[model samples]
Target: MTDYETIVYVERESVARLMVTALRAHGFSPREILDGGLPGIGTGLTGKGLAIAVPASEARDAQPLAEALLKDMVGK
Candidate 1:
């Protein structure tokens, strides 16, 4: 099994997809995990969020670019 490192947590699917696209555009491979799938009938409802992760080795190389992308995204 391969271990993945969590990079960013996004509350909206659209934001998550945008982050993924940005990562890809910057030449970094990222993965998205949709948490809060149905389990105990509404138990995980509040946990519905998306997580973006990349390989541990690539994290350091991707951080600056991701940060810049996020800055542009959030208008910071």
Candidate 2:
């Protein structure tokens, strides 16, 4: 099996959620990681930001799109 690696890290949970949805719509298996673990209630309040991760094998392809989405969201 392949390992998973974070492709993008965003400070806002909203952006992280959007990234997960966008990545999923593109057929990539994306997951949200909070403080190095799966997210739960009160997690986002820690102030440590969140991450969007995908399989290491797909990281190269997903990184650009993830970064682009993040940049776009931050612009608005």
Show where candidate 2 strays beyond 4 Å.
32-48
lDDT of each: 0.69, 0.77
Q: For model 2, which pairs clash? A: none
TM-score of each: 0.66, 0.74
TM-score of 1: 0.66
Worst 10 residues of 2 by lDDT: 34-43
Can you write out model 1's per-residue Cα lDDT over 1-76, one digit (the tens) per residue? 5566766555556667788888988888887545556554332245644557888888888777776776777665
Model 2 agreement with the true structure over 17-63: per-residue lDDT tens digits: 88899998998998644444455632355565576789998899999
